[model samples]
Target chain A: MYGPSIDRLITALRVMPGIGAKSAQRIALQLLERNRDGAAELAASLIDAVDKVGNCSSCRTLCEGERCTICSDSRRSAQQLCIVETPADLFAIEQAGGYSGHYFVLMGHLSPIDGIGPEEIGLPILEAKLASGEVDELILATNLTVEGETTAHYISSRARAAGVAVSRIAHGVPLGGELEYIDSNTLSLAMQSRKVI
Target chain B: MYGPSIDRLITALRVMPGIGAKSAQRIALQLLERNRDGAAELAASLIDAVDKVGNCSSCRTLCEGERCTICSDSRRSAQQLCIVETPADLFAIEQAGGYSGHYFVLMGHLSPIDGIGPEEIGLPILEAKLASGEVDELILATNLTVEGETTAHYISSRARAAGVAVSRIAHGVPLGGELEYIDSNTLSLAMQSRKVI
Candidate 1:
């Protein structure tokens, strides 16, 4: 057991994703022993980010301003809007460097069992944007999980009702992936979605 | 890419031990998305710990007051002093629940290449404690690394000069370790240090 403050620090650090008790202790001890300045800077950064950062009004992604960089960039296409479950997913797409469209972050998917519905994920705002007729195509870039598929299906119907074309990001064997190592579901999807050579 | 504050938070999170860039990003985003209150608490805890926690005047371990809990405990033996490389090592020994003596945390070992020496590890304070004649036995519980052994050897000589009985913690096969799976170095040490049954 450590001092009260150290114990509190270790407990607080466990709030981060994937960090457990031992790791929290290790991090706390490491900060206190070796990098107190770094610890102080991290504290300042966390406070600053928490105090200033909020969801982008347009895309619902975490940002310090009204609009995220991608949403505010005029060069990106207003015609195509990609829907993602989280800002991390949006970041992944951005890192891949293939998409030039703006993103709409759901922050989470529709989980009826968990009582997370359309309103919880700001679907009304998305529908309002769709109704404005600014977005001509809606790309569903949510994860490949069941919740993601269900969310995509629900949004696709909304987009169709709003007279906007909808498309889902394809899921199959990844680039440079060996078919022998790929799962049967993905293989089946790859077989079914085969296009003309 | 995320906004400036989000990016700064991610970068700052990387200051913790074992947290790389991707982990930092994941932690930052998870905190922002799911646990803003937890994030703020962690920030507050970090500031509180950094501002308040300092080395124990007696043992050189991180603590809030003039002395660490172990150093201030009157019931614990003053006749035995255990020297450890860091407060983490001291905590590990405490968690094992065997030792009941005071501790002197070195905070680090004799890392010569890094310009760390006796004063860097608070060896002078340890020597002063040894000279005080309160401790009859000195236990070396630093890590089993080269630097740790070097530090132990260096301190043992000092303790010997101060007329204190010294002993090193056993280095051998662990309690559940199988000889076939054990490393040759540990097995050799186990063989050499074998006690008559």
Candidate 2:
């Protein structure tokens, strides 16, 4: 370590996901050695983000203002609401295109063992939105993992009780994925959900 | 992107060595979604480093004050000067736990094509330190690439003129590297530099 400030920067960098000791050191040194001005700008940006960005008042996705971009955009379909586990998943869905519906980010999936219940993942906000009668359909776009499935099921039941149609995103072979490499469960699901050409 | 602050943070994160668009987005979203306090602390640390850390007056390595810890330490051998390309390389050598000598970081190698000449890499400072007669042995620990070799040769000639003995670190099979997986040039060097075991 060069000094206390450099060491502190390295230590602070480890709070980021996937950054270990070696990576933290490399980043710290790179920031210090290459572009001090860029480093200062990055620091300012980080602080600004930490201060300004927060949960969207409407859909719970990250936003600088009261509503997220998707929630505020008049072009996006409010009747078909897509529920995702995280903002990263929402970004992935947006990048894929073709989905013009607004999204409600759960921030995390339910984990009963860890005491993360329906309320913990912002299920109440979703239920209240569903009950408002504005959204006609709820598209559960949570991940394929066990926790994601449980969360999807819980939300589906709530939507159904509120007279809103519920649909889970398909689970099968990924696009361009070879059949041989596909897992048995996914192959089975793909077979069960075979559609007309 | 959620907002201007979020986008700015992502752009700033892209300045990091290997972070790309997706990685920057992931990092920004993670920072916004959770651990805002940690992100704020990282920002503070980065600004502190940018404001305080500078080149050591004697060795040109990163430091908070005039001289770095290594240059100020009286216990380390002043007669043996190990020249390296960067502080990261210096850290690697220190972690290896064998050499206990002073170091002079060039910060970069000499590349006339890129307009980075001897003076650009602080050769004048190095020459002045060598001419002082404090150092008897000059250890060239630059990398094994073409530029590194060229820089080492140039430094060796200068050190020789100043009556300081010059030596390049041995190039061969790495300590934990398997011969089969290593490059052909390294294999050739390993064979050429084979010593009595």
Candidate 3:
């Protein structure tokens, strides 16, 4: 039970994911008591990001300007496009490295129950890109969940119709995965998708 | 990863308590994609709180003005003063309710190894308040650790010299506490400090 400004700050802080009442209160107290200047700077940065950042027009990835960094980089292969569900997934791929290709972020997967269908995930833009004959191979790097599989299958059909080859990211044991710790489904997939050594 | 603005936003968010790199990135993405308006409002609120909020001149509690609401309220009992180590503890006491006395926040406790001494906890301010003859009883509500005990002992001696009666908050089993689950030290204290009905 602090003053009005403190109450307002706690309320505002709760908007961030994973922050609850106690956490919001603790963070608010710390900001007010210890790091006022740093808090002010963080606030300014948040506002600046909100005002300046938007979805990249070319690939739907987040960017400060019209085109995202990956989309603007000419070194990335236009013929190899990676499809993903969200911006976080796109960033995760980038962090892993070695994938020097363009990305077409769906922004979300095809979830019909949530009223998110093909158009909702920006399928028209992807189809247009495919029809332009720029992308020869589409890499479906969506998550391995049921929804992701369904979305990937739908996009694959669309890519086939547009005369583009499509490939899904492999599903099996992770690089450091142990068979004992791996889930039964993953172990089965690893067994079923065995490759010639 | 994302864009320059997004990167900056993530870095700024990590300054908040408990947020790590992955959580910061996730929150940044969510803000840009889902709640841009809310993010903007939070930013504005953070700036407003940082620019306006300061310590109460009388009691060292956080406030938006010269005095905190509790210190400014005229109805509270000036004869009974509660001494606390931090504003968080004061707030905790208020949340528990029933206490309606003036407060003198230490802002910290005596930790010599950490370079904190009696002066660091504003002993002079507390001594001045006691000598003013406004306070008849001084309640020590510091934590239960070794530092809290040392601080309380130091303050008790000063308060005795100033002709003010001193009392400490009780250390016993918490309400709704199971006797079997209580720590041995707490059980011993409860046994040693048994009260008459």
Candidate 4:
């Protein structure tokens, strides 16, 4: 119903994660009618980022340089390496402002049905990092999902065999979570892992 | 927390309507991580559309040439001109498959508070078209807002002065809307504008 360029733009907008036909149409019309400058800036930024950004060589996180800022930072402990499923997870931990350690991004967990295995997730690079003797403590910050647990277990064993201590991040009720509303599985985990406070 | 290019891309993604900081980050990361080719295509499309698309000279709707397809089509009746608020509204009317007349896009309604006058909405062009003696009827398909009513009244007065019959699109309960759920203003309008069976 729209001109060729506008139609093409609406179709192209559907490539984003959650955008569907109606949303794509709204977005395309909004950009064309209201904010041409913003649209141009978005286009330039997309081109710039896509052309420049790549995985950090050391940690496999998205970055423009050879190493991510976290990987290159000298103050963060090299003795401890936190394993996460994605760059977004790495960002969440950084935003929480708790850990002051290096990180290794797995990008995804082991999902054999989808053909994602250890090697697919760059586990050999992680093994090499473990064998490097620089990391003494391997922190499992991957999610508590089944695939996450499986990947963590696989990596923990490899790290232990390489003489590195391994620890999994706690899984239970969140800090402000009410026990009554918490799921049974989480409540069970919390009860079983009760600490002597 | 991210590299320069990635950070720029995230910030740029916020220009999109309804995209917040978190959504922007997710979109940027998803594009960079999962579909670089899609990202590149979106960028190319945005640039192409922005560079080529312009307002149709006759209707002021978005198009790549001198006139929009509706304006250029000889089959559409030039005697019945529809005045709409935006190209999106024009597209909506066309999609409904009822109107087969030329359109004049106001782009916006008359808003003195926002300093938008008739001239700002290209009323001079509309006046010239009304004076051309070709259009016998003027259809006001603007929104049901107060501003839209004011603009429609203003244009209707001008059409009357130029000896053109004027009509406003009906205002009342939607086709499938129940009377119980309908707003009082719309219900009152529906009551006043009732057609005898």
Q: Which predicted model would earn the best DockQ?
A: 1
Question: For each candidate, what's the DockQ?
Answer: 0.90, 0.84, 0.80, 0.83
True contacts recovered per prediction: 0.92, 0.89, 0.78, 0.82
Cα lDDT tens digits for candidate 4, A60-176: 999987898888899889898999999999999999997999999998999999999999899999999988899989999999989999999999889889999999999889999
Q: How do all the candidates rank in terms of DockQ, highest first?
A: 1, 2, 4, 3
lDDT of 1 by residue, A1-197 (tens): 69899999999999999999999999999999999999999999999999999999999999987888898898999889999999888888898897898889999999999999999999999999999999999999888889989999999999999999999988878999999999999999999999888
Instruction: Estimate every model's Cα lDDT from 0 to 1.
Output: 0.93, 0.90, 0.90, 0.92
Off by over 4 Å in 2: B176-181
List the lowest-lDDT window of 10 residues for candidate 2 chain B: B1-10
| lDDT tens digits by residue: candidate 1, B18-48 | 9999999999999999999999999999999
TM-score of 4: 0.95
Error of model 2, residue A160, in angstroms: 1.4
Q: What is the Cα-based lDDT of residue B72 in candidate 3?
A: 80
- Candidate 1 Cα deviation (angstroms), residue B24: 0.5
**Pairs in clash, predicted candidate 3:** none
DockQ of 2: 0.84
TM-score of 3: 0.94
Q: What's the number of clashes in each of the models?
A: 0, 0, 0, 0
lDDT per residue for candidate 4 within B56-171, as digits (tens), equals 99999889988888998999999999999998899898889978889999888999999999999999999999899999999999999999999999999999999999999988
TM-score of chain B of each: 0.96, 0.95, 0.92, 0.94
